[model samples]
Target chain A: MKRIAKLSTLSVLVLIMVFVAACGKSGNNNNNASPSPKASEAAAAPAAESAAASESSQPADKKVVLGFAQVGAESGWRSANTKSIQESAATAGFDLKFSDAQQKQENQIKAIRSYIQQKVDVIAFSPVVESGWDTVLKEAKEAGIPVILTDRAVDSEDTSLYKTFIGSDFVEEGRKAGQWLVDQYKDASGEVNIVELQGTTGSAPANDRKSGFLDVITSNPNLKIIASQTGDFTRAKGKEVMQAFLQANKKIDVLYAHNDDMALGAIQAIEAAGLKPGVDIKIISVDGVHDGIQAASEGKINFIVECNPLLGPQLMTAVNDVLAGKDIPLRIVTEEGTFTSEQALAALPNRQY
Target chain B: MNRMFRHHLFWPLAILAALLLFNLFYSPDFFNIVMRNGHMYGSLIDILNFGAPLVLVAIGMTLVIATKGIDLSVGSIVAIAGALACLTISRGTDQNALSLVLSAVGLTVGLSFFLGAWNGFLVATTGIQPIIATLILMVAGRGIAQLITSGQIITVTSDTYNYIGNGALAALPFSIFIVAAIYLIVSLLTRKTALGLFIESVGCNPQASRLIGIRSRLIIITVYMFCGLCAGIAGLILSSNVASADGNNAGLWYELDAILAVVIGGTSLNGGRFYLTGTVIGALIIQTLTTTIYMIGVPPEITLVVKAFVVLTVCLIQSEVFRKKVVQRWKTRRYPAEREVSRHV
Candidate 1:
């Protein structure tokens, strides 16, 4: 009995340690520690980097250390964004300390605090949520570390907390989708019936996207959204909900999915229901993910509003300007484009995500 | 009549029927089944097709609950199994090859068994609470899945693999046949042998059963392993249906749904008697509610609220005490003088 008890206790301890280690490793990538300051600075001697990097670096000996805390890899878009940031940081010859928050605001906050303690030259983070970040941003400000917001913004009233915010406007993407649909049906006579597949309810993207689309489509009374449902930003839910939508309604003129994944799922449902997706019911979707772009090129979807995940090159420029004592805009929106089948076909070969 | 009413499955089936009837009233064509391209298509067919995963998971959950244990890690297992399978298939040169699809599926199920064994080891051997033991995997399993898929959705184009989720057999969904086979096999395994009685005995009093020479610990582990196997199969169907496996979103909240199905099926959470058929009915009710909500065109924002109310009504109806109280109140309201006279007599 005593031996068994001892063994079990030892095993439990081992298991607990394993879990803690896994939790720590899964979120927050601290792998690129840059092998001490001297070696990285020596290796980063090439002045043939980005234009901003070449101009900002006067002394090759001193390397700018940047700490970036990213939201977890929840979707394809998020992972692409993370990749861009990491690659851009490497190209700019900045010592980047990257942390994955695993979709937790508390983890992001902790990462930022650690960066502050380390006295990094600059701090950048794509916050997991908009609210409850004022305190953490305030701490970074007091610590004399300038902060940059990427992909998402904090809800703090103070403008000085983050030097600049960089991301695609979700609402603007929605408006672009609505505008494209309006343009498509401008010359037509009959009312165009639309069914909306929304993202997770109450999420910033879902609320903003819905509002933006409504803001645009309400102008033209010819376009009507007969039914709307949340797919929780997932493909399976998208197909399931779309099936019901098809069964309930006899005719669906258009489908506006909050993201590409849902749109793809809806396309499958449409095909299964014996209707050609782009021809029978026009599909307008946001998020120019590779899969979404491919669908557009295939003529399965009619229009797509690009929500670009590649913000790294632009973010690097902003960081360089900040270090060079050059003033930058407070809200730096990434330039995004809309894609039709023709444009999508031409852009398919060059698509990254 | 009383015995039939008192059966464990009675309230669950009634509730499911009531839900279906409500849908029929709400939409006249709710029960219409049409054949299109050799496949059955309708709201009813969809409930069965979509609810197959939940039913499979709940069947295994019923057995685990019968052995007085809860498997909270089933959702994570579902995600892990799908991620592993999709990753394997995607790496193969010919995704459509029968050998590759089989190997991928075999590897997924094998991994699930190992994961289940780990949970069983912790719970049965170390005497950890079932909830706590499984919660470890529930938290870490998604991360492991993400690692397997490299944080990207792995989409596969294998017709063979898609057959499990989308292909029709005999004018009905192939998923329904899978659910039926599993249900039959599980029922036979538990009922045909002494396994069912032993499970109930262990659940009733583990110490007494062990003292009586029953291997309670082995039974607990076996039940959990079975649960893992069921989750793995469910994972396969889910990923195959979408032709992609999303490590982050696949099988999210499935464990809760399975547990709810078990509870609503009239299986006591305290653990003793189990009802496999009732659990199936419970799963159907849930799927039906979701479909009804969509068919009724309930606003997207309040969809959850509507679902919660329907589930609450089902649970309330399943409670014997609640039913008796309701019936007694109706009797008293209708016959106040008769009640007083009977009391005096």
Candidate 2:
């Protein structure tokens, strides 16, 4: 019994030591830590402004603190979108309380409620999904806080719940992709056996893209979707499903991916099957990501429809306009266009967002 | 008869039957099968193909759980294995069938084994909780995999590697065959030998097992190692099928699915008895449910809510109150001869 007790004590000590070691290792290898020159500049600017404001004759009224609950960095585009919002908030002189929901709706709702309790002047969020926001939005409205939808729209029937939505027209983006495909494959005699790699099944992009593409493509009887599968907006699953499609179907002419990741995955699968992706199987994808543009330039992808993720400047302008009692459109669509191989190459270097 | 009824396999069979019955009226063509390209094509086939990875994970999970331990790191291990295989093959190595396959398999298994040992060392030697110990790897494994692949999807054009994931034998997926072979090996190693008994003994009463001269710590470590090996195999299969290694997304959320499969298989999360066959059925149920949702054209967003509901219902039925109610109903509906058998038991 004594030996057992001693052994247990030793084990407990070892466990503590091991945990410390693990934590120490993680601390040394912090991946999220990056040198932020912009952050430092912004911090210094705030101090300078406060000093200048104190010296001024007129004292500033109550400060407006706005809380922005961002959907976590779900994709590269999402990360850029969040950065835009953060930078814009800092520049606009609002105390921005940002919380990343990490792609979970419950976390977003919680953050919104916390912001409401804090009595933030305004609330903004890029919801992780469309549904389950009506109740929260209603609560925000009751709390006398105006909410702005960014990048993506919510599915609330109550339009008065949100002040305004600032983002790209996702359906139009799909229509553009469809129209481009129609133009490219107009001369093909045989059936245009297309395989569509969809985004997240229930999200706005997947639903709208599917509807919009179908609306345009259904007119052409030859353009049939031989296989349509959800790649879940992920590259890995896209490749897997594409492989399954190749194994199951012999004739696949065109690949229409919901996003660049899926398109890239499909490209990998196409190359693995010993077929040229852009030549043998024409590829058209959305989201003008750097890699996607590079692929298009390299003749691996045929066409790309840009879904602009940088909405900071426009969003901030809309917010200021609304606050200044200026009329704003219910939906402010970002300016976006399609790009072919030549265009992709021309814009590859200058592409910022 | 009482013993048979109390067996873990019996619960999964009952749950599967109940789900099928529920789906029969609600879902059209639930049992419909079609032949295409000399292979079966239908919702059922799709379910089997999709559930293959989950089945593999659950089988590994069963052994781990039987040892009173859990491996939350299987998902990451899968990513690492895929990354290793893809990186290795993309290096323009000789396409000689035997060497290529062996090296890929060896590297994946070896790395996984090392990771598993890390988990084992933490849990067994240091006395850390299995969940917490494995969680470390779970959080960092994908990042490690990404580092291995340099955050790039390594695409390979190897027929030998592709055959593991995409190939078929006798009109069935090669993955299904692999799962079957793994099940056989695991069953033999555990059930047919003293390993299973030892694991159960250790799980049921750790102190007693130690008193009886069983090396409980060694057993725990070995179980984790086996789970790692299984995950490595799963990773190979996943990468091979896609013919690419995507470290960022490979086997993402697989751990959750595997744990869900294990729980649905009637294996108590608290640990004790294990049922390999039940795990297979549980995996099938999950895949079939997913396919059914897709076939019914339910919007993808509501699938999570639906899955949660199904899991809730299954858990409710598995509860003691529900079991008692079921038994009472069964007793009332039975014939006199059946009643006599029940009374005798």
lDDT of 1 by residue, A188-229 (tens): 789889999998765667877899999999988989999999
Query: Across residues B163-241, which tens digit of lDDT does each residue of candidate 2 receive?
Result: 7876767877788899999999988988889988998888897779999999988988888888888888889988887
Candidate 2 residue A181 Cα shift, in angstroms, is 3.0
Residue runs of model 1 more than 4 Å from their true location after superposition: A1-69, A93-123, A127-146, A154-157, A320-326, B328-345
Show how many residue pairs clash in every candidate, following the order shown.
Answer: 2, 0
How high is the lDDT of residue B263 in model 1?
93
Query: In candidate 1, residue B266 scores what lDDT?
Result: 78
Model 2, A1-353: lDDT tens digits are: 97897698688767866986786457434422332455335334434443343234223565557688886644556655665666655555556787767567898999999999999877888877788788989999999888988877889888999989988888998898888878776787878999888887667788888888888887778888877878877666676567556655668899999998788877866765567999989998988877779889998889899998767656666655655566788998888888899999999986654
Candidate 1, B1-345: lDDT as tens digits: 989988778888888889889988888888889888888898889899999999999998998898889999999999999999999999999999999999999999999898888888778888899999999999888878887776778889899999889999999999999999999998898889999999999899999999999999899888889999999999999999989998888888899999999998878888878988888988888889999999899998899999999888877877778989999998878767988999999
What are the chain B TM-scores of all models? 0.95, 0.88
Output the number of the TM-score-best candidate: 1
Off by over 4 Å in 2: A1-67, A83-98, A117-122, A142-145, A185-193, A243-252, A269-276, A316-328, A349-353, B1-55, B68-73, B76-193, B232-250, B260-272, B275-345
